[model samples]
Target: MELSFLSSPQIFFTVFTLAVSVFLYIFIYHQTNRRKTNYPPGNFGWPIIGETYEFLYGNSEKFIGDRMKKYSPKVFKTKVYGEPTAVLCGVAGHKFITANEEKLFRVWRPHSLQKLFRAPFLPNASASIPRETMVNVTRAPGFIKTEALIGYLGKMDTMIQQHFNLHWEGKQKVQAYELMHRMTATLSSRFFLGFEENDPRIEKFARLSDGMTVGLHSFPINIPGTVFYRAKKAADAMRMEVQQLIMEKRAAMSSGIQTQDILSHMILSSNPAAGRFKSEKEIATLSSALVVSGFTTPATALAIIMKYLAERPDIYDKIRAEQMEISSSKKLGELLNWEDIQKMKYTWHTSLEVMRIIPPFQGGFREALRDFTYEGYTIPKGWKVYWSVTTTNKNPECFPEPEKLSPTRFETPPPYTFVPFGGGLRVCPGKEYSRLVMLIFLHNLVKKFKWEVLAPNENMIGTVIPMPGKGFPILLQPLST
Candidate 1:
C-alpha cells in the first residue's frame, strides 16, 4: 500500500488525545472563569452536566431546599441548563425576584423553550417590543374582552356537555388527567382556532402541546433521538399548522364572515387604528401559545382538583352542593352566564387552595440584567435565577400548615405570599381566563358525576407539570337526580 501521510494509528491517536485535552482545558477554564467572590454557596457539580440530572430526575424542590438548608435559605447556587444558577426561595425571595423585573432581571427562557416557542412578541431580552407593551396588546379591549368572554360561556357549557356525553357518559372508569387534557385541548382549540373538538387537527395540536411540555425541562440538545429534538419537530409542525390556519382565517375575515375566535381577535386588533399590529408570524406564535397555555395548565389543575376531591369526600360534597345550587338557578336547558361564574365563589376558593398546594407552573426563570446582591451574596451579571413557587407556596410562614388544604386561606391571603399565577408586572394575563375554564369545567363535572380515584396514593410527578402518576384513574358514577 502507498504510504499516506498522518494515516498511522499513532498519529490518529495523538490528534484524538489533543482534541480531548483541548476540550477539557476549555471546559475547566470556562468553569473557573465563571466563578465570582461571595457567590451563593453551592456545588457547581460536574462540568457540562452540572446538577441538572439531580435537579430534574428527583424532587426539584428538595434539591433546591436541601441546598437552601446547607448554604442559604433565601438564595442558593447550582448549575442547571449548563449554566450557573441561583435559586431564590421563600416569600421574601419571591417578592425580591418578581418585584424587580426588567430592572434587576429580565425574562429568560431556556434554549429549549426559546427554540420551541420562538415567539418574537413575547417578553425576552432580544424582543423588539417591551414586555409591558405585549401585555397591553393582549389585554386590549379587542382581545379576550369581557364581552368576548361572556360569549364563550355558552359555547363552553355546550362543549362540556358534549365532551361528557362522548367520553365519560357510559364509562365506568377513566383516566382523569388524560380525559381532562383532551377536554381542555378541545376547548382551547375551539377558542384559539375555531377547530371542532373532534377535529383531527386538535389531537395533533394536543400531541405537540404534550411534547413541548415534556421536553421543556429536558437538555437543549439537538441530536437525533433526543427529547428536545422531538419537541422541536413538534413545534415546527404546530407552526406550519398555525400558519395555514392564519391564512384561512385572514381570508375568512376579508370575506366579511367575521369570527370571534382568538385568531380573528388578533386580526382585527392588527388594524393601525387599534394602535397594535402583530405580524402574521407573531400572531401565529402567540395563538399557538394560547393553545398551549390554555390546554395544559387548566387541564393539570382540573385533574389535581378532582384527585383532591376524590380523596376528600367532605370537600367534594360542599363543592357539589354549591354547583347543584348554581344548576338549580338556571332554567331548564339554559346555559351558564358570566353571572353564574361570579356566584361560584366558594368553589373558586377551593380551587385556589388546591393550586396553593400544587401549582401547575411550579416556578419560572429570570436572568440577572446586571450584578445584583441578595442577602449578601452577589449574583453575577448573566447568571440565571429561579424563583420557586413550590418553595414560596409551601412556606410555613406563608401558609400556617402548608400541606393542609384550607380554602379559608384565600379569605385574606397575605400580600405576595400566594402567587400561583406569579406576581408584579409579569403576572399572567390569562389568570381570569384560566379561572373561567376551571370553574366552568368544575360546575359541569360535579353536576354530572362523582368519581373516586382508583389509584392508591397516586402522587404527582413530571417536569412539565406535576400530574398524577397513573394519570389518576378514577371510577365514575352519575350523580342521582
Candidate 2:
C-alpha cells in the first residue's frame, strides 16, 4: 500500500530534479571558467549572433576604428558577419597581415559562392574546387606582362580616339560612371581579346561584366529571380565568350597570324622546352578574371578622381595646367607611351594618395588556420582576421595629418603603411596596366574638357566599394580650340 502511493508522483518528481541539477551544473561551470582566462576585451552582445548586427548595419568600420583609438595599436576581438573576427589595427598589424604571415591565414571564401558556382566542368553538386585554382584565376599577372601591355598601348591610339568621339559627343551631362564603364570595356577588349572597336560581342561582354557588381551587396539567397542569380548567369555567358575568343586566338596563332593582343601572348608563352603553355580553359578563366577585375578598379578610381576635381575647382585648374603642359608638343592622336606616363610623377603621386584615402577594397578578411599570438593576445584558431584599409590609412601616427590629401605624405611614411595595391605575393599584378590607363585617360580628359560636379553633398555613400551617392554626375564643357 505504501509503495503504490509513492509511485503515483515519483516519475514527475525525478524529471524535475534532473533538470534543476543540469542547470546548476552549467551555471557553476560557466562562472568558474569565465574567471580563469583573460580574453580580449570586446562587447559580445548575445550568444550565437554576437556583434553581427552592428556590421550588417554598416557601423562596423566606425565602431572598430573608435575601439582602436581607445585600445591603441594591438590585437582585439569582435564579432562580425556571424563570426568572431580579430581586429588588427595600426602599422605593425598591417605589416603582419600583408607579410609572409599571410601564408598562415586563409582567404575568406563564402559558402554561398562555393555552393552556387560549382566546379566549372564537373556536375558534382557537392564538390568544391581547389582554393589554388580560384586564386590562380583571380590573381592579376604582375610586371611579367608589362612589356606586352606597353606595346599594346602604343598601337591603340586610334582606338582611344574613336571611343572618345563615339561616347563623348552629343551628350548633355552624361553619367560619369557610364562613360568610365564604356571606356574601360572598350579599351580592355581591344587590349585583351584583339577585338576591334565595333565588335558587338565585345560590347555585350562589357555590359555583362559591368552588371555583375550590381547585386554584390544583397543577401546571399539566390531565389528564382534575384540579383545573385542574374550575376551568375551573366558570368556564365561571359565565360563562354572568353572561351570562344581564346579558341579563335589559338587558331590564329597556330596559322602564324602572330597578333599582339594579350590572348596571343598567353597562348605563345611556354617553358624553356617550348611546352607547358596555358590550356584553353585556363587561359579563358584568367582572361575573364582580368577583364572583370581590371575594368572595375580603374573605372571606379577615375570616377572618384573626377568627382574630387569637380568639387575643388582649384585642384581642377592645377590638373588642367599639368595636362596642357604635357600635351603642348604631342598631337591629339599621338600615343602616350609608358615612359610618358611615368614622367608625370606628380599625377601618379596624386593618384596614389587618392587610393590610399579611398581604397576600392576597404576591408580585407583572412581566417586563421592555426592559433597565433599578437601583442600578447592569443588569437585562437578558426577566428577571422580583418585589416581596415580606411581606418589604417587615416591613422595619424602612420600618416601625419592623415585627413589632408597631400601626395607628399608618401615621402616619409613607414614601409607597408600605405598599401593600396596590397602587399606580398598576392599584390595586384595589373598595377602597371592600371597606372598606364589612368594617366593617359586623365591627361586626355583634362586637355579636352572642363567639367563640374553635378551634386557635391550627396556623394558619401560607403559599401564594399565606395562611390558617389548620386552616381557621379558631371557637366562637361568642351575646351576652346
Q: Each candidate's lDDT (Cα)?
A: 0.80, 0.67
The TM-score measured for candidate 2 stands at 0.79
By lDDT, the best candidate is 1
Candidate 1 lDDT over 1-481, as tens digits, reads 8876776898989999999998988788667746555888877777777888887778866776788889888788888878889998888888897779989998877767767766565455233333454466567654456666887788888998898889999899898789899998998898778886678998889888888777767887878999889887877778788989888888887888867676777777775554344567766766776788777888889988988898888988898999999889888999999998988988999999998887877787888999989999989899999877777677798888999998878888888787878888888877777888899989989988998779868777875467777888999988864
**Local error of candidate 1 at residue 12 (angstroms):** 9.3
Model 1: residues with Cα > 4 Å off, grouped in runs: 1-35, 120-137, 145-147, 268-282
Model 2, range 244-327, lDDT digits (tens) per residue?
Answer: 888887787788787756666666663335322335654565566557666777888888777767766776777777767766
lDDT of 2 at 320: 75
- Steric overlap count per candidate: 0, 0
